[model samples]
Target: MPKVDAETIVHSIAAETNTPEETVARIYADALDTYRADARVLDYVPLFAARKVRATLRQNSAKPH
Candidate 1:
């Protein structure tokens, strides 16, 4: 796959999860070190999209639908 650095991953994840940019930056670095991997993929970036999406949907649903 394509090479992905911590910074790129950070911005993407932050936008997707609505997390703090700085925290996302740190989390990206930590995840890289935690997994000891060389490259990251969009399919698995930050690995928290599903939960975030779920939470968002729940909140939206709580209002109406």
Candidate 2:
């Protein structure tokens, strides 16, 4: 797993989802905590949910022709 940094994660999520960094930061906070992988890597469904959010957004953005 990639090490999660507040700035890096926020930037990445924003870039990937075309969302604001602040929103991603909030999502991170609601999803995890100080350091996303700080100590709860295998005890929650947040990580999956975050990825799902991004994936869904990406899918929605992709036009079907």
Candidate 3:
């Protein structure tokens, strides 16, 4: 797999989810940290982190304000 760039991921996620880049960046960082903690294979960390952050943003949006 090609190397993933965090900035690209952050921008893509922010655009797709209609979220702010700053917010996405913060969440992506946290998600990356969480996944990195127990990841045995480092190659998929960015993919996993991006998925997790996207899911989290979606879930949060679904919740009642």
Best of the candidates, TM-score: 3
lDDT by residue (tens digit), candidate 3, 1-65:
89899999999999999999999999999999999999899999999999999999999999999
State the lDDT of candidate 2 residue by residue for 1-65, as single tens digits. 65445577668878878888887777666655443556555544455646755765577669686
TM-score of 3: 0.94
Candidate 1 error regions (>4 Å): 37-65
Q: Find the 10 residues in a row with the least total lDDT in model 1.
A: 45-54
lDDT, residue 23, model 3: 100
Q: Sort by TM-score, best first: what order?
A: 3, 2, 1
Winning candidate number (lDDT): 3
Cα lDDT, all candidates: 0.55, 0.65, 0.96
- Note the residue pairs that clash in candidate 1: none
Question: TM-scores, in order shown?
Answer: 0.48, 0.50, 0.94
Which is the winner by lDDT between candidate 2 and candidate 3? 3
